[model samples]
Target: MRVGIYLDDQGRSLDVVVEAARDGAKAGFASAWLTQFAGWDALTALAVVGRDAPGIELGTAVVPTYPRHPLVLASQALTVQAAVGNRLTLGIGVSHRVIVEEQFGYSFDRPVDHLREYLSVLGPLLRGESVSHRGATLTAVGAVDAPGTKPPSLLIGALGPAMLRTAGELADGTVTTWTGPATLADHIVPTITRAARAAGRPDPRVVALTFVCVTSDADARRGWVAQRFAMVGQLPSYRAVFDREGVDGPGDTVILGDEASVERQIRRLASAGVTELVALPIGSAQEQATTTDLLVGLNTRAG
Candidate 1:
């Protein structure tokens, strides 16, 4: 399985972000991911980083689908694909109600239907075909200029069964967080693979996102991570996943331990049918660096 690293979005300058991607590539990480939020647009930063780290794959852990229409997103993704020499994996999602409705002032009703409509237009557009798609919720009438760019692989942040089915049927795969190996092997992989087989598509990719920290003080580290990432567990979709995984909260699902323990868990995830393990390292500066160094070593050793 491939290994990827998720970069922190801490208001770093563009040069700093690019330099980080360069460093990640030099360390032999297969891919580097960025998130979309208030700080920096993931795709834009990836575009800038592409010039410096052209050999490494670039992705978004996800960009929200509500604010930007699929046509618009496909346009930007294709542009980034061009910049990155066709090494873009466009991960997108219907973000939480609090962020979509309350924060962005966009309606978050019937997201499954919305995603279905959105992908219908977005997929064709990414293939360089014109779209005149009209659905109950979305209408995309034109295609953007993507003359020389190759189409990017599309992934969805699907947690629930319905979303998983949709991901298998429509997209290349799903990216997950706060989900453990047991839930993935028993539920996620099976459900999505069944849907993909039914749709006559290739086996969908399963990208597992985990917070990694090689430390003895796991309980203490969980406390710190909970302080930073606990709100994610409150999101309805994430809560459902946590419940299904038999976990009390997001902290329980994190991958934290010493070097050997962490490596064993990563192998278990691969055995659980994960195509990629995207590690989001967390902890103090020294711990984070150590975790990253181990991951960089894993990229070479595991390969």
Candidate 2:
């Protein structure tokens, strides 16, 4: 399985973010992905990454699909893809209710329907084709200028059944967080792959992001992890996935332990059909570097 690193979003400057991506790439990591949130836009961050580190794959853990139109995303993704010489992966999502509806002043009803129509317009617009559709939620009637490179791979953050099927039917792949192998094997993987085959499409790639901190101080590590779980447990979307995985909370899905245990768990995820693993190191640079160095070494040695 391909191993990548997820850059931290908290209080990071553009230069710092670029440097982090470059460091990960030089450390033999396959890719460096940036998570989108209120603080930074994914495309802008990746443009910096493209300029700073050539030849390394750059991606958005996800850009929310509610506020921005897909045409805007297609244009920005193409620009970044060209800047990176086609090494960009545009991962988009219909984000949860709290952010979209309560925060952004957008209605949260029928997100699945909205996403279906959104991608319908996005696919053609990204492919440099004109799009004109009158759906229940979205309607678009033009195409953006294509960048020099073809559109980057379109990945969606899907955890639910309808969204997973939509991802298979339309987008190139699905990216996930806080989900486990059993959930993937029994629910997500089969649902998506079957839908893709039914549509005469290639099997969709599955990339999962999870907390990966390597430290002997289990208490400190658990404290770091608990903070994340507290927030995630409150989210209705993630809680449903946690329930499906039969886990108590998001902390259960995190990959935290000694190096050997972490390695074994990641391999189990790969065996369960995860194509790429984007490991999020949840501590300072020194701590992150320690885990990252070991993981990169292990992956290279395995190769």
Q: Which number leads on lDDT?
A: 1
Which consecutive 10 residues in model 2 have the weakest lDDT in total? 217-226
Full-model lDDT, candidate 1? 0.89
Q: What is each predicted model's overall lDDT from 0 to 1?
A: 0.89, 0.85
TM-score per candidate, in order? 0.96, 0.95
Candidate 2 residue spans exceeding 4 A from truth: 283-287, 301-303
What shift in Å separates residue 28 of candidate 1 from its native position after superposition? 0.4
* TM-score of candidate 2 to 2 decimals: 0.95
What lDDT tens digits, residue by residue, belong to model 2 across residues 1-303? Answer: 788888886698888888989888888888889888778787888888888887678889899998888878888888887788899888989989988988999998999999999999998888899998888898788888865778788899998999999999998889999998899888888888988888899999898998887777656776767675688878888899889999877777888777787788888888888888898886666777778887797667645
The parts of candidate 1 lying over 4 Å away from their true place are none
